[model samples]
Target: MELRLTLSLTAALLLPGLAIAADAHADTAPAASRQAELPAWEQLSAEQRELLISPLRDRWNAQPQERARMLEHAKRWKALPPEARERARKGVHRFEQMDPEQRRIARAIFAATRDMSPEQREQFRKDWARMSPAQRQEWLRKHPAPEGGRGR
Candidate 1:
């Protein structure tokens, strides 16, 4: 998938986009700049600071290419229209609220559909709509998310 689409899906499916973007490039910043920025970070309430810090820490710990990609993705996210950003934010929030099984179902659907043609996606939706709750659960049990996927 294209990086932008992948980021959109991952952000919508996995984490909130705007918050993570802020932390993406922190490590590449010069030391003096970081030092100069410390007080601003300190001024934030612990909750506010954590909103930014955790993502930065994750970025810092990522493989070099992954870090660079995350930074790039963050930049792209920043450039999105406000409505688009809001939509993604809401999507992340909804995803965050799902029970693990629901999230697994979501991830399964996402993985199954991400690469589909329009017609194929339509057909899958039709098939999905035909399944009873138990059947849906059975389908999901047969096709669990890849190891450690979907917030596991």
Candidate 2:
């Protein structure tokens, strides 16, 4: 569930460049450059489109119970305003930039308080920031991270 929350948070900006980069024989450039220059959906071939959507498809198949929630998330993402979508894309990019440990803490915190109001989340973050390392660890221990939300 935690993993689902973290992933759903980014569904608005979930362009699978990996699908493009996976074309080993065709893409002559280095993998990094290929990923950097991902083609638009219409530009890609049928295979590329399949590869792009495969992860989401596989995840959907694997988690039957979460299908309704996941579908709702996609609908909500589509319903967001253009400016709001851009902000979400930027937020995902910022989240991607954090170090591994920071990412772990972020995912954990996000999973813990995703249902809170904005003001409440801000207050929670302030309280979290005030905790000592040991206290933070204790807090984490008490509210352990879910299996797949470990910043993998």
Quick one: best lDDT, which candidate? 1
Give the C-alpha miss distance for residue 135 in model 2, angstroms: 2.7
lDDT of 1 by residue, 1-152 (tens): 22223234544653333446445556787869977876765587887677676766776686565666667667878887888777777767666666776666677766767667868876877777788889877977886766656432
User: 6-97, model 2: which lDDT tens digit per residue?
Assistant: 44444323322222235544557886887778777789899877766777888789989868866876777778888877766765666666
The alpha-carbon lDDT assigned to residue 118 of candidate 1 equals: 69
Consecutive 10-residue window with the lowest summed lDDT within model 1: 1-10
State the lDDT at 64 in candidate 2.
Answer: 100
lDDT for each candidate structure? 0.63, 0.62
TM-score of each: 0.57, 0.60
Looking at model 2, residue 108 earns an lDDT score of: 67
Stretches off by above 4 angstroms in model 1 are 1-11, 14-54, 62-65, 150-152
